[model samples]
Target: MAESDGQERTEQPTEQRLRQAREKGQIPRSKELGTAAVLLSAAAALLMLGDALGEALSMVFEQSFRLERAAIFDPATMMPALAEAIGGLMWPLLGMFAVVLVAALVGNSLLGGFNFSTQAMMPKFSRLSPVNGLKRMFGVQALVELLKSIAKVVFIATIAIWLLWSQFDHILRLSGETLNLAMKDALELLLWMGLALCLALLPIVAIDVPFQVWNHTRQLKMTLQEVKDEYKNTEGKPEVKSRIRRLQQEMANRRMMAEVPTADVVVVNPTHFSVALRYDKDKPGAAPVVVAKGLDEVALKIREVAREYQVPVISSPALARAVYFSTKLDREIPDGLFVAVAQILAYVFQLNAWRKGQGNKPVPLKDDLPIPDEYRV
Candidate 1:
């Protein structure tokens, strides 16, 4: 569906998208960097352990050539000698291999860290398609890889040739030197050559690392619609969120209406607004709190609930609207409207008292209640 949109991918990927890609083992990695590191590590290991390696190799050569009368006649004796010779050769090589392995792992980890994912190990049949294979072989990525390979070859060859040419005089005189001196000269020359090659590779690694990162980021670019879709997936679809909000409002209204029966009075703006106020003499607040409030149809419902529960319904348009707008449900009415609500509550109490024949009938509530001018609207 996203591909069908034909939207150009321009935006940088979000963190979630990047994280998903990482989980799938799709992370920037430069093969050149790992190759260079392994090469350098192997060269360093050989240089550091040169004496020990030479001794091991000499032992292997000596063992292979040394023939005792028993070793020459007995095949079983020969097998043990051959095995000892092989073990001598393997030790130095194994040390070099270990160094190379460590270097390769460190180089790869420097860029993308360590991520073990089976998703990358899974094979896809699409890789077998000729068209896809040709595209991969001749694509921009392939072209870039070809260029990098050519550059690396040229750089290494140039360094090697330059080093060898500079040491040509020394090389020609090697035949006149003692065996130990000749061996030392050759070792030094090889070390210099290896160092030169390693240095040459540094530039290629520098360029390839940034190129790999850029290519990976470009491939992960997101279209505008994709961003919106991802947002919806992570947050919620707009319509679904709206429906949820509507359901929450309905539930809140039901709960508010349930509180109407316990309210001392329901103040109304005729048929438009309604606010149910409740006051507890033992509560800390000095004024009544609005327990329920609604507008229009909800107001009608509040009034009906109030009547059904025999709660007093007072017509106070300004006070009702003011309380409904300014006060939150289950919170005390603002100080500005305290006097007005107090007078209404006093009237309701008096009416109740009169109904039970305990007090004189209260006068009708005045239109001009003690509501502040600012709260009039």
Candidate 2:
């Protein structure tokens, strides 16, 4: 029933959504797996150190019960004896506890790496609501948890019953043995019982791990509109992005138009294209740079700017298109068009001289300017 924009959440969660969930400490974890690991660790530790622990306990009991009149009367002596006995008993058990703790840590880490988020620790008032609490108690997740608990109890009970039933003859024989022999047999029986219980939990843990992972993934499923909205949040909203692009174009156009007034000549494609060129002979190895270029309305604006500054404007559709395409703004024209551009510059200079009454008007501007064949298109 989970939906967004009237569409069900049929799609798998995206990477961004997964990352956010992890940041919020929502990761797949199996409590049953951790419990099984701890139980197994405790059983293994007891098997390995059981004899040492038993001896320590026996020594503590012997010391506590030893009848010494002077020790009983002296509070200091009795206190030291009691403390030593307790410490000796605790040392071996502490080692076993440490092993179980390590196993629990490793089990959890194997499932979800290491996740520490303060957001998960924060209190939520919604959890206190009676209606919400009832919903959670009767939810699918709650039912699954209840079933898992039942299965664990059944498995352990079956294992215990079978182990005890098979060892029934051994249990009866223990009463006829000496005290030391009877205690040894009982310890061995308990060890076997612990191992059987741990073994029974393995199958349950295996199923629970995958079930927890699948359930977590199902909860994070995203709808189509949710995916789109997340994409917009990560990339940017469409309208805002379009506005940014428009602003960038306006800034570039303004910069190009500003350079037109400083150009030596403006090459026009009659209506569609315009490119302004400027050459500085004083600057060594410098070719004419395209100071400005534009199309249509921008081209007309460039021509107006050129005319305001008295820069010459020549209508040469092929040359204008070639220069506009080949040259970048504020960069020199390509070497392939060197001869053709040089001829036009010479013509412009000659025309300028004639207008100053220093030389006769050079041949009138013609349609066939010395344009390179390669640049014609």
Report clashes for each candidate as comma-separated counts.
0, 0
* lDDT digits (tens) for residues 270-376 of candidate 1: 97999999999786745788999999999999999999999999998999989988999889888998889889989999999999999999999999898888887
Candidate 1 deviant stretches above 4 angstroms? 1-6, 63-77, 176-185, 242-377
Q: Which candidate number has the best TM-score? A: 2
Measured on C-alpha atoms, candidate 2 has an lDDT of: 0.87
State the displacement of the C-alpha of residue 272, model 1, in Å, after optimal TM-score superposition.
Answer: 20
Native-to-model Cα distance after best TM-score fit, residue 296 in candidate 1, in Å? 18
User: Which pairs of residues collide in model 1?
Assistant: none
Error of 1 at 210 (Å): 0.6
Off by over 4 Å in 2: 2-5, 68-74, 176-181, 242-377
Return the lDDT, model 2, position 335: 92
